[model samples]
Target: MGGAARVRRGAMRFGVERRDRPASERRAERGGTGRSPARRRCVGRPIAKARGMTHSPLRVAVPLGGTDRGRSGLGTWVQAVLPRLARRLRARGGELLAIGTPRDLDAYAAVLGEARPETLPAALDRAGASAGWHLAALGRLARRRGADAVLLPAANRRLSLGGPPTLAVVHDLAELHVRGKYHALRTPYVEHVVPRALRRAAAVVAVSGATRDDLVRHAGLAATAVRVVPNGVDVERFRPGRAPAALRAELRQALGFRGPFVYYPARLELPGKNHLRLLEAFARAARAGALPHHLVLTGSDWGAWARIDARARELGVRERLAWLGRVDAAWVPALVQEADAIAMPGLFEGFGLPALEGLACGTPVACSDTGALPEVVGELGVRFDPRSPEDMARALATALTHPVVRRRAAEEGPAWAARRSWCRTAARLDALLEEIAVAPGKAVAA
Candidate 1:
């Protein structure tokens, strides 16, 4: 009658296969492992078999948050990983199960068409009230589907499903470390939900070693419990190419821009991104006539757009600023490739994927010297103190003026980006899954 009930029926119908049975035999006789009445039943039979059978398809359940109605950094990461994971798993004779809230189901379904998708109860949307019921429902569903492993694509409340081990990708430990920096509404959610999830996860993957260390130190997670898996770029999609004159013309006309442009491709989040400071820096540079290039701000989330617009006007650089709100995915690579230099002045980040991507497109980068940006950018680009507008202005001026620095960054940046790939990230994930399945005790906190 319900999703969980239907899943239970499916699992009962398919049953568990024996280790001794041939692949064809198992397929032909889809019955529960007919063990002797006197013998004890294996509580994790389906999961054990799923892991033990090297060639057998692994049924992985990946739970996601709501899809990006706005082109958000987190959304971009999800978009990059999910479809790639699905294809890779399918190729290795595995199936994927995408579980998300009703808001996320349609988008996830569209991306992972072949994989089975389950939407959680709509009542779970209420703040702080649905944790118990949500976990219970998720656990039952995962057990019914006999998931080999469950992947939480984003940090949320952890589900203690009895059937499968869980893997959570902690994008950052910003909530734990940078208190009172985010919106008041989010503070309670993070305080209650995130730490509990981190403690319960079988393996915690951080986007950078910096974030991993933060998790270990601040969240009381064991260092050995964490693994550093850096976010990667789509190399094939984001390569250097000539931007069509028509598109350039459109952008110029829309924004009243008639000169070379430097792009800051990120959401207009305050405090965390330090966007107000960035605007001040841009204004300082503009007033000095040091930065001849227009500044383009791309990707604005809800409630953030108006703030950024007001900041631009107040800075007196509204005419020089282009607010390209949520550009198409296909256009992003092209836009990055066309920019003279890509700037990320964020005060903190788990991993600066945009900087990595801009470098991959052979655009020189100028970013902050904080959080994971230094680790991600390495020696490829210029680093500035995000807190100081003067520092940012100076750095932008130098980057724009210095040909030798830009040349070296442009030459070396793509090669750096090329070294990290989604394929490689996925391979590492596969190994982690195997290790967790075979020797789960090894995954215990250090």
Candidate 2:
């Protein structure tokens, strides 16, 4: 556990202040409590009695425009969550509004039948515009709709131009940690804009405690201002016992891999995701006859593909590696089901979704145990040093060779994933919304 221990120690001394919580309780989580009901409906809808209604229910505005596929993990997150949030707001007779281009509006409308989506101004459709311009468009939209609060679900690149209660959900600060992972345009955004946006926000939602700490360390945010609401897994969609034999065969054929294969479903990039080290480890294991399976990587190359491909060839394991770029998201659970094991060696992660999904599907999981990976995987996966190819090779070998560890992963993984439902995650965000919307004076215990 040297690597895991080192990671824990490094995080503790990462120069971020750690507040002492009273041992009596952990008031740690997302959203605020006691959101009292309003006397009226939403702003647009009129009151009767000659209008019997009084004050209107709070309106929450969410922006939803972006391409899915390989473009944005933010897209994936918003697609999964906003619909659920819409349902919750509707149940309370509150309004949930969406602002985006037609593509964005349609995407949300498809899921949220009752969702009120408006196409944004044409200026927002142009690329390379300033974040301030985008925020201005949203502010005008918010004012028109009489929104009480605005949630920037994918607020990594931009901050509010100032309007109603504005909150941003920060997934990770990977740029602060790994400078080379992002492109030039994005480098400035992460370094300058994201921090400013977060600081100016009414409150920021950090997806993990590690991320909350990053907010404090990198962006100089108050620990009290950043709420820790973890990302979640859809257990029913990713659970064990859903892998039918015929569907498994079909998926394997489509992915063009046969026999036993270890899966690493991360985008191909530089040293950030540690794909180079993973290929090195896999090659060494294959050469030593320690590994009997091929390695299937299932994401498009963000950058460094030529280098990664060349390295695989040099390692003499090119044929043993399959570069299945960006398969349909729907195929992920089935792919996890068919894989012999799941190996992740990312240098950092705010939360490791694929690892958790693989575990949910009862697959043996191996990861670098750095950043949020240890907390996300818990005991359901094996941990190794991402910096050491030898350590990673041994961990992968163990996951494939050891019977007891493999058995525990299959038998105990569901329970681990079951505890991390999207509902619970959404509830935390909902609470944070309440706090930001109504109880602006209070600190979020979560």
Candidate 3:
């Protein structure tokens, strides 16, 4: 009856392929870095360092076990960090194995060349259910593959109960803020399963200080147990520039928009993402006629989208709003560049990736003062209370008005974004993993 029960029916037999690591330590090097060349073409500074790995080689696997592409924020985090991680590990004479569905595996292949994906018991694939099964399964496979440690790149609390040292990445504890939003089994999993999982990890990586704090307060973990490694934008792709003329023309025809627009690119998650309140604010701006910009909402329909659509109609922004569904990561830059401003009115976030991405593109950003947003947004954009539409409307209006001061902030935004580099994040994370692997008297410390 529950999601976990179904996956249990078809539990997997851990027969993941064999002999992934090199027999000897005479390797050359790993893949370079993660930032795509298209983005790099504009800003030549590489975000992934080419520094060789540690003296003692350690096998590492960034399992996609709990992270799904496109379907979750973990997807974005992986797309940004894993490639660089894979390379850094390989440079250290370590192997990086991907464990996920065929599609998820393929997504990482381009960034991590030819590292075969591992799987769970055959029956579990059909069940297509996630009840933290992958958590245990991945741990077992990592041990079998002789992995020194495993990195769980998603925010899910599900974790491998035992086996190799594990590091879990916590994005946010939104489930606690908004009760009754997730499915029946999921609620229990997060409340019970996650804290236990955090305890199981050798160490934990929090995307922001806020997230690190939540882990301590909500999960009852020690502050020393968590480390803050904020997310970084792909400055190469997100920097200021128009879309390819062809791209602009194609999008114009499809969306039929004639004026500059404000972008709110995030999955349509309910009160959690605060889409409804944003719509109300946009409606107020429209009524006042102070801002004539269109509102573009990209990303798939998550839970409360019907409510969002209905509210959109109520606010009379149906005409001004453009629903682009999900935009490919490749196109996010042009989308941000072409916009008048980027709006992130989420109730909570571990790290506001889109807001940073917008700033990297030299576009003004308007975000809520809650969560890690205020910290991430800093003075780059206007901050308002996500609960008040009047506040959001005013922030949106000021950004669109294009004041000289705001324009200067937009102009200086990219350099500010560049300072938060994936290279730096990766270096810090790499050091942490090796610290866990080589700690004396224990394989890892929590």
**Candidate 3 weakest lDDT stretch, 10 residues:** 23-32
- lDDT accuracy of residue 418 in candidate 3: 64
**Candidate 2: which pairs clash?**
28-446, 29-446, 31-431, 31-432, 32-431, 32-432, 47-51, 48-51, 48-52, 49-52
* Model 3 TM-score on a 0 to 1 scale: 0.83
Model 2, residue 72: distance off in Å is: 4.4
Off by over 4 Å in 1: 1-55, 66-70, 125-136, 156-163, 177-181, 188-193, 440-443
Candidate 1, residue 104: Cα displacement in angstroms equals 0.6
RMSD of each: 16.0, 7.4, 12.7
Candidate number of the best lDDT: 2
Flag clash pairs in model 3.
12-121, 13-121, 39-236
Deviation from native of the Cα of residue 377 in model 1, angstroms: 0.5
lDDT of 1 at 217: 72
TM-score of each: 0.81, 0.83, 0.83
lDDT of 3 by residue, 194-272 (tens): 8877876788888877787788887878877677777766666778778899888777776797788889988887767
**lDDT per residue, candidate 2, 1-446, as tens digits?**
44334334433322223344333113322112311112111222221212233433557888764334124456667766777667666766877787776656655555657568767665655445535565566767786788878888766665666677777887787767776776667777776777766676777887767787888887777777776666767775787865678877777787676778999988887878999999998986665554569888888788768888899999988888887788766677887887888998988887788888888888988887677777677756778889999777767776776666678789977666655656556555655666567745333333
What value does the lDDT take at residue 335 in candidate 2? 78
